[model samples]
Target: MKLVVRVKLLPTPLQAAALEATLHACNGAATWAAQVAFERDARRPLGLRKHAYAEIRERWGLGAQAAQHAIKKACDAYTTLKANLRGGRYGRPGTKRHTRALSKPVVFRPEAAQPYDDRMLSWQHQTRTVSIWTTAGRLKGVVFTGQAEQLAVLAEYRQGESDLVRQGGEWFLIATCELPENTLNAHPVGFVGVDLGIVNIAVTSDGECHSGRRINRQRENDRALRSKLQKKGTKSAKRRAKKRASKEARRNKDINHKISKRIVAEAERTGRGIALEELTGIRERARLSKPQRTTLHSWPFAQLGSFIAYKAKKAGVPVVHVNPAYTSQECSQCHHTARSNRPSQARFACKVCGFVEHADHNSSHNISRRGWMAWVCGARSTAPALMLVA
Candidate 1:
């Protein structure tokens, strides 16, 4: 498994200025190389590197590895464009009626950064410093600080590449580390269903619901503040609003991390696999009103699902995505499928057998059953469907 650990870097004023200059020069070279490659229709990395390396090295005052890194960045941009074209994500470049504009050159902000390979960067564990090759020359003794746990990981499992990033007037070093993959001795005994919703972020088959009430309240407050700031129409107000938005996002992400940790821990403790709904394109299918659309779009269902899957993998607990159709309406007790079974958002009442439960809880139960059938049958097509038996 690969993990990235970010540490705060404390560079001297001079070293900070040099680092800033190096970032700008490297990104500038990348922008220029991308423009040249786009104009000449060159997509191959080798050809692009060969074309731009010498110019970048001399003009940008970058070391050899730094110059190659710039070329690689440009080539990667073209590679993304080519993949988009092939996948029909966008129209071909240089066409009159293209889906996206390709005329404008790619520009990199000061924060837009590049990676340092082993040849261009070295870390000192004893000194707690890193030395990096830059346009102004090599800068050594750049002190970095992090939690003891992260420093320990860095000392033991640090990989070859690290990215230098500047954000909110702070410089950080993000180091990649290699870790052993988790292996479990026991197979999954059962499946735990997780139902994701706007009201409750997630509801498990074991009757645990992580409420989204606080998240929703916070988002609404932030949205109101943003609207008020936008109406004021001042530069400082706008900047403050943007910062507030960033803070809100960070808070939401932290909440998701916690919720996912709990869900994965439950599955791991019980030796059960996790079952989640395959909810692709659910927003489009819902055909919600404008306000509802905004609310639904802001929901972090996808991020929460990804967190659960990755954490589960690291804990050696399996995760499966099941078809979402009729999961909410299907009765967990009687297996009767009817839209009327879910009379309201929170309540689930079966029409025929009169089994009642929380709507999300019933859905989770149905989802767990579907996951178990998929696991046992080994094929979705052959999986037996829930039916009412007389």
Candidate 2:
């Protein structure tokens, strides 16, 4: 499995200036190359390189590798844009969003992250320093710091390219680490099913609830602060709003990490697999009021599930993604299916057998049983069509 490790780069003022210049030059070249490709309707990397390679090298004072990388980056952006168009991510054809996206050539920000190959960047794990190529020259001996575990991972498994990023007045390098996957547990005693939701965040078959009430409060506060700052309409206010947005994202990722670690640890210790729900197409299918929609859109259910899956994989714990349909509406105790089984958002009751339980907890139990069945039946573990046949 591939993991990413981020470490802070403590560059000297001169080195930082050189990095800034390099980013500005590379992104400028990329923007120019993309514009040329869009005008000529050229989508192939080879074609773009043929047209813009030497130009970028000479005009932007980039070396051979850097110029090629810049052009390749522009081509990759177009590829992504083309995929988005085909996938209806910008809306269907003739829609305002889709038409607007087609109206402009792609542009790169001056400080956007840039990928560096081993030729351009080298790390000194023992000394906690890096040597990176910059516009001025090769910037060497730039000190870096990260969590102890992350540093260890970098030393042992770091591989391939790394991205140099400048965010919120700091420099960071996101290094790719190809860690070995643990031996998978083929025979598990049971499964720990996790139900992900906006209110509760996560509920396990063991009746453990990881509430999102506090995180929801924090999100609301963040939204309010950003709205107020944006309304103030000052440069400093806008800057603060950006900072808050980044901070909120960091918090979301941190919380997901903690939750996933604990869940995977518990499953590994108990010799049980993990079960998650197939929540694809949820945003498109769900209908809610404005406030509810805001909460749903902001909730990090997918991130939590991904965190759980990768951590479980690292721990040799099997993971199954079960069909989410009717999990909340079906009664776990009596196998009765009805919309009325969920009397409220948080409560479940089975009318046929006079059974009741917390809604999320009941859903988790149903999911766990389904996971066991799927595993025994040799069905695709992550298939979304593993139907519940209660």
Candidate 3:
């Protein structure tokens, strides 16, 4: 399993200036290369390199590797644009949006992240410093910091390329580490089904619930503050709003990481696999009021799912995605499906068997059973037998 570890880089004023200059030069070169490719209709990296490599080195005064990287970045931008165009991301062909996207060559920000290979960057884990090649010169003894665990991983498994990123006036080196996966547990004792919801955030078949009340409350406060800032329409206010948005995202990501770590640890300890609800197209399938829709769309259910998946992969725990249709309203006891079975968002009372249970708990149990059927029994029924959680 490959994991990305981000470490903060603290550089002296001179080093910072060099780094800044390097970013601007690299991005400017890349933009120029992109224009060349656009004019000549040269999308292939090697062919485009032949056209722009010499110019990049001379015009930008970049090193050989940096020049190659700038050209490669330009080629990659075109490749991404091609994919987005094929996927109709901007719009269908002939539409104004689609035409506008293709009208000009893609341009990169001056502070855009640049990749550094081993020849261009070196890490000293013991000293917590880095030595990197800059356009001005080679910078040495640039201090850096990261979590203890990430630092250890970087020392051991860090390989290939690391990106030098400037975010919010701070420099960071995002390095990729290839961590070995644990031995696979092909036959699990059982499955831990986790039901994702707005109120609870997550409810496992084991009846463990992670409440989302705090998160939602804070989110509402952030939204209110951002709205006020937007109405103010000042440059400082807009900057504050952007910073607040990034802070909120970081907080939410931390919460998801904590939740996923706990879930994966529990499943591994109990020799169980995880079962998740396949929520693809959930936003389109469900109907809600405007306010409810806002809350629903704003929740990071997909991020939580992905967190669980990667953590489970690292732990060698199998994860299965079961159909989520009617999971909320279906009774775990009688397998009866009806809208009326769910008296409210939090309560489930089966009309057929008169079984009363927490809505999310029952739903999780159904998901757990379905996962077991899919994994152990090879039964991929749309509706599997449900029962009380063990």
Candidate 4:
């Protein structure tokens, strides 16, 4: 498994200036290369590399590897744009349409940030520092610190390419490390259902709920603040709003990490696999009022699901996503599938069998059953039984 561990860099003023200069040069080269590649219709990595290599190295005063990396970054952006066009996500017609230009003043490619080998960018275990390459020269003994667990992983796992990111006035080294996959344990005895919703972030078949109330309230406060700041229409106000948005995002992400960890740990401890609803394209399909749309769009169901899956993989616990057709409206006890079964957001009362339960809990129970069915018969066969309810 590959995981990225972000280490905070403690660089002196001079070192920081050099690092920033290097990033600026690299991003400038990347932007130029992207424009050249687009105009010349050279989108492939090698083609773009060939077109930009010599010119970028000479003009930007970047190393050979850095120049190549910059070209690769440009090519990657073009590839993404092409993909979006192919997927009909561009929402416009022509393949040769004008592409958006890079606006960031400082961005570093992996090679620009590090090097081909550890000689230029390597960790010193004894000093707890790292050596990083820059445009001016190599910066040795730059202190970098991460969480103890992440530092331990860095000590053991093989480090791969990394990017040097500057966020909110702080520099961070985001390194990708390759870790050995955990051996799968015995097959799970049962499945734990995890229902994801807007009101509650997640609810398990075991009746545990991770409420999204706090997150929603925080977002509301941030939204109001953002509105007031925008009304001021001042540069400082805009900057403050941006910073607050970043902080809010970090807070929400931390909460998600904690919730996902707990959910995966629950399944691991119980020796059970996790069952989740398949929510792909949910946003596009769901019909909602303005308020409902805003709530649904802000909810991070996909991110939470991804976190759970990755964590479960590390813990040797399986995760399966089942059909989400009527997990909420269907009665878990009576096998009744009707909108009337779920009369309210929180209540689920089956008219046919007089079954009553919390709506989300009932959905979770159904999700768990669907997951078990999938585990037994495979995902393909689980859909036919999706409407069966019980």
* lDDT values, one for every candidate: 0.80, 0.86, 0.87, 0.77
Which residue window of length 10 is worst by lDDT in model 3? Answer: 381-390
Candidate 3 backbone clash number: 0
Which candidate tops TM-score?
3
Q: Candidate 4: lDDT over CA atoms?
A: 0.77
Those runs of model 3 whose alpha carbons end farther than 4 Å from true positions after fitting are 377-390
C-alpha RMSD of each candidate structure in angstroms? 6.2, 4.5, 4.9, 5.7
CA-RMSD of model 3: 4.9
Instruction: For residues 323-387, write the lDDT of model 3, one tens digit per residue.
Output: 98888988888899999998888899999999998999999999998899889865331211111
lDDT tens per residue, model 4, 1-390: 777677789999999898888888888888888888867878777887777789998999988778887887877877776676667674556433423322222233423443234544778866878888888988888888777887787778746676787866778877667766676544778889998887888899999999668877877787789889999989999999889887876776777788888988989888988898888889876767887787788766776777777777777888888888888888898779999887888999999999999999999999999998888876421111011000
The window of 10 residues in a row where model 1 has the poorest summed lDDT is 381-390
The TM-score that candidate 2 achieves is 0.91
| Displacement of the residue 5 alpha carbon in candidate 2, Å | 1.5
Q: 1 or 4: which has the higher lDDT?
A: 1
Query: Which pairs clash inside model 1?
Result: none
> What is the per-residue lDDT of model 2 for residues 1-390, given as tens digits with 9 covering 90 to 100?
778888999999999999999999999999999998999887678998888998998899998889888988999998999899999999999999999899899999999999999999999988999999988989889999988988998899888999899988899998888888788889999999998887888889998888668888988898888889989999999888888888888888888888888889999999999888877988887767788788888877887877887777778898888888888888888788999888888899898998888999999999998888878887443312111100
Error of 3 at 43 (Å): 1.7
How far residue 18's Cα lies from its native spot in candidate 4, in Å, is 0.9
Worst 10-residue lDDT window for candidate 2 reads 381-390
Q: What TM-score does prediction 3 earn?
A: 0.95
